[model samples]
Target: MKVTQIPFQKIGFFSKTMLDYLEKNPKINPFYNNFPDFEGFQKQIAEKQTSFSKSSRLVLAEALKNQYESFEISEKTKTNISLLKKEHTFTISTGHQLNLFTGPLYFLYKIISAINLAEELSVKFPNQNFVPVYWMATEDHDFDEINYFNFDGKKVTWNRKDGGAVGRFSTDGLDAVFDVFSEHLGNSKNAQYLKKLFADGYLKHHNLADATRFIANELFAKYGLVIVDGDDAKLKELFIPFVRDELEHGTSFKAVSKTIERLANNYKIQVNPREINLFYLGDDYRERIIFENNLYKVNNTEIAFSKDEIFKELHKNPKAFSPNVIMRPLYQEVILPNLCYIGGGGEQAYWLELQDYFNAVNIPFPILLLRNSVQVISEKQARKLAALNISKEELFLNQHELITNKVVENTAIETNFKDKKQFLEQQFLDLKEVAKKTHISFLNAVNAQERKQIKGLEKLEKRLLKAEKKRQTHLVERITILQNELLPNQSLEERQRNFSEYYLEYGITFIDVLKIALKPLELQFTILEI
Candidate 1:
């Protein structure tokens, strides 16, 4: 296996805000407490320790132990869980939706990034224990987004009706999804392994939350990846104070709204904060809680509570309250003894909107780091790319631009009209000089003529490019085919293709190879060829 690192700027897939944040642009400096690096963790660790109490740590450890008890927890994971009770222990977390079969290739990358970063920090701060955490977005209600995963060009879907927090959704319908997958998987040993894996995860487990926990633990337990579902009573008990504050004063909405306004001056706001960001969770419903008519009302429902009644409800059933996107980060930070957050670009963007809120609530904001973005190419594909004289950088170009450039490169014609334009500019320069000796109107006419001539040259250049493309049809087709393979469906392979597609060929070693290749602190795009 070989690995190549490219800066995110060259990849052109990240947003300007993400790019700037990664580069530590002064504009983004005000939004985050500490920049993500080994040095940055020092200040974050100190701040988190000052606020994270012994009682909170006990609650967190107990919740994790209870969650891990149902599964076959590895020795390393048990140790990591025990370490959470120690003052020297801290967590590095990355949260994700319970996407079926680990929705995209990046899901694995995100967790691997957290694991590798925790390992690095353990070595760096030898006295302190670092644990990698995968916080399951169990309360996320977006069924349409998490119900399907792309395998090769086909979408393996679980077409089922679901409601409430997705974590509680029954896994009874996954058998049909498994049959569809089996038909595509054929009869390889890896396929059989995956079949059993899916059966043990979804078919055997009662709910989506447990199924996802089983699947993630199966794949990553060796590295001691601690999985936590936030929809637990014990965890919510720790967050009750903040939830109450949200209900009383709407603190998060006020602070986050200010930050969003300031952020919108230069960057796009990722998520808008509602007046009350907490939601009321029921058996088959997760509805927003809105304060209106001097009463706490659950959106789209007739259930309403007075201020005193709502406070009593929160104390009795803290788990019944779920935080939306805006408040979820605060909830996670409140419950865990975490130092940094590892996430994708979009996650970081919304997190940026919450720093002011974190400050307002008097909790230390965790350092936000974009997870490692990867592009995997086969050796055969690498060789083909070389034969076409395409560099690694060329692979990142947009589809049309890549094909156009290849067409021009393969054809025996000059597609660029730069020299012609330069010559025309020089002629115009001479004409302007001559017109200067005559009249101002004559110079204006020369300027008009120059514009007309440049427009003509541009038109000619387009026609020549079209002619060259027609002549190099075969070359264009080959390039298109190669690009499509490298970037499936003209999208990033990690975003569209599932990891199982590669696992079939490489087996479990595929994950080991990524663990070896990924450097969470490197903060660059990686291209790995296996």
Candidate 2:
């Protein structure tokens, strides 16, 4: 396996907010507490060490132990969980929805980034321990988003009627999905392993949360990856004080609104804050908590509570209160002794808006790191790309742009009329001088003629380029076919395809290559040729 790194900006897929943050743009600096570097981490460790309490660490460790009691865990994972009780141990966390079979290929990239960062941090700060965490978004209620995954260009879906929190969803109907997915895999050793992995993960577990935890642990537990389910009552209890603050003062909405007002002038706003960022999570429903008519009411539901009643309910049943996108980051930071957060560009964009909110609640904001992105190319595909003489960076260009540039480069034609255009402009300049010497009205006619000639040259240049493309039809076809194969549906492979597509062929070696290749702190797009 060979690995190469490119800047995120070169890919043209990441947002300006993320690129700016990666570049340490001053305008984007205030939105985060520390940059993700060794120096920044040293400062972050100091901040978190002072802010995170010993009692909170004990609670976090005990909660993780209870959550993992039912499953057989690797010794590395067990050791990491126990080490969380120590004052010097901090977590490097990445969160994702429990997508079926781990949704897209980047799922592996996200967790691998966390694991690699932990190892690097451990080497950097030998006295301190860094545990990698995968925080499961079990409280998320969007079932449609996590119900299906693409396999061999087909979407294997789990059809069910689920509401409330998705983590609590029963895994009764997943056997159908497993059967369909199994049909796609042949009886090779790798294929059988995948089949059993899916069957045991989904068909055997009772709920989506447990199934997801089992699968993630099976994949990365050997690396000491600790998976945390945020939907647990014990975890929710730790967040009760923040939930109460959000309910009474609407602190998140107020603080994030102020940040967005200034943020919108420069970058795109990711998520808008509601008047209240807490949700009322029932057994069958998860609704937003809204304040109206001197009462706190759950939207689309008849449940209503006065200020005192809401606080009473919160203290009594903290599990019923869920944080929305605006407040979820605060809850994660409040519970974990985390130094950095690894996520995709979109995740990092929303996180950039919450620094002031974290400050308002007196919670330390962790350093936001853009997760490692990768494009895995097979040896055959890499050879095709080489034969076509297209650089890996060029593969990221728009199809039309890539075609135009490559066609112009390969054709024996002067498609770009740079010299001709410059010469025409000079001729026009000479004409204007003559017109100036003769009469002012003549200069307008001269200017009109110049514009006409320039337009004609541009038109001819485009026509020549089109002719060259027709002549080199073979080149265009090869470029399109290779690009389509690598970038399925004209989108990043990580977003469109599942990791099972690669695992079937390379087996565990595929994951091992990724674990070794992905470097979170480098913050670059990787092109791994296997």
**RMSD (Å) per prediction:** 1.6, 1.4
Clashes, model 1: 0
lDDT of 2 by residue, 285-363 (tens): 9999999999999999999999999999998998899999998888899899999999999999999899999999888
> lDDT for each of the candidates?
0.93, 0.93
* Model 2 misplaced stretches (Cα beyond 4 Å): 437-442
TM-score (C-alpha) between model 1 and the true structure = 0.97
**Given candidate 2, what's the lDDT at residue 449?**
90
lDDT by residue for model 1 (20-101), tens? 9988898889999998887899888888888899998999999988987779989999999999999889999999999999
On the 0 to 100 scale, the lDDT of residue 521 in model 2 is: 87
CA shift at 415, candidate 2, in angstroms?
1.5
Model 1: colliding residue pairs: none
Clashes of each: 0, 0
